[model samples]
Target: MSSRLLKICLIFIAFLFFSCSSSDDSTPSEPDRSYEDVKTDFQAIDFQTGVNDVSIRDINGVLRFFRVIIPEGDLSSNLRPLVMTLHGASGGNPDAHKNTGCFAEEGFAAINPIIISPNGGNLDWIEFANQVLVLSLFDLAINYLPVDDTKVVVNGYSNGGNGAWFYGETQPTVVTASIPMASSYNTFNTAGEARRIDVPMYVIHGENDELFPLQRTQNWVEATRSAGTEITLEVAPGLTHNEPCNYVDHVKNAAIWLENDVWD
Candidate 1:
């Protein structure tokens, strides 16, 4: 072979050898996984802390938004309790529920449970479809986060309070306890329909509720009790239906009940 031709061939061989060696050393590219894929596939999303506004797609392919508050620390060793909050009619501000309503406040130190306050497209969460969507998100959160499935708690206000009642009665197996505040559920009106509730429910109501009278809630509690369901009702003195911020104390006590009375 000619000297010039021989040199060109050697250069080509060196290029090929280096290219193959470089390819072997490179790390494989990871697949682009969406939040929807995280519902089934694990390890991609991790158990995280702090406040996060997560938008996830449910099993039925419905897009949903929730404000999650995780405790500030490592959470891998132990499974933490989970609280799923349902917003009121017209999608009561979930941010307010976490910040103002103080559900997320209990998510540290002693009452440290993961809090999920969901926004149901600003629609009435009491609707069957919205409730199902909230439950779907709850299931997805369980798969993605480290949660103590046995201590799942549901809490809501106003129309969302009605949603809480629905889960307490219908989904007792999944829900460990429920706290329904300022809720007026007329649908569970009849004794026969309101007959049975399998889970522990602690209710909080405004004494001077303007839109929904305190009597409405009392009657429902009495009905459920009469039907052999153990329910507790705490009427906040001088509280009104419109005052959402004033409900913090009552909710805090309810958290105590869950931690000390119910879960322990």
Candidate 2:
């Protein structure tokens, strides 16, 4: 072959060899896994069905407390949904757990969600420190339990309901849904806060609640809905401020709604 043709032929062979080598070295990328894809290998606790108290210092250096209720099941087999319950003002962690009936024998057999109730230091949940504390406790729960990160629901009564709105509005990505009962946002800027909420919400309140009247909850719901938020409000007739006694049914229904309606 002529010298020039020989040079061109050699260059073409080198290019083909480099292209084949590059194709061989390239790897097919793995699909991205979401939070739901990640699972704890074993049960964090021994699957005892009761309330467990947890205490830890929050980001603000304040001593914070929370309670967890594990259902009677083999956590090793299924990753259960998590429900973070907030208590009303002056309500204890255990009291909130009992009031909600989340740990009741029948209740556990029904919904089977892992429950976490965190104390708000007797302050409004809109308080920055309390918000930080609640989020911190959530992180701790996920790390310590066999919690399904994708199926987290935040619900509360009275003051806790208020906190539920706060977390549901601000941390939509973290909390999947919100259920607030007998609560109104008396502390936060409801109109401004509503614009930030992106998750679905189920709100329940007593029509005759002396502390937080039903109209207030209605107004908040209206404003939130106007802000393009998905919310449903249920007003119980003749119910008063301390309506938890008459509200357990609503709570159970909400749990069903969370499972079948929202998450489904």
- Model 2 per-residue lDDT tens digits across residues 51-71: 665443322234455567887
**After TM-score superposition, what is the CA distance of residue 42 in candidate 2 from its true location, in Å?**
15
lDDT of 1 by residue, 104-150 (tens): 35422367888888776666775655655566556655655778878
- Runs in model 1 deviating more than 4 A are 1-43, 58-62, 91-110, 187-193
- lDDT over C-alpha atoms for residue 127 of model 1: 63
Indicate the residue-level lDDT of 11 in model 1.
36
Task: Tell me each candidate's TM-score.
Answer: 0.76, 0.72
State the C-alpha lDDT per candidate: 0.67, 0.64
Instruction: Please list the residue runs of candidate 2 whose C-alpha ends up more than 4 Å from where it truly belongs after superposition.
Output: 1-47, 58-62, 91-109, 186-196
The true-versus-predicted C-alpha distance at residue 22 of model 2, in Å, is: 59
Q: lDDT, candidate 1, residue 83?
A: 84
Instruction: Score candidate 2 by TM-score against the native.
Output: 0.72
Where is the poorest 10-residue window by lDDT in model 2?
15-24
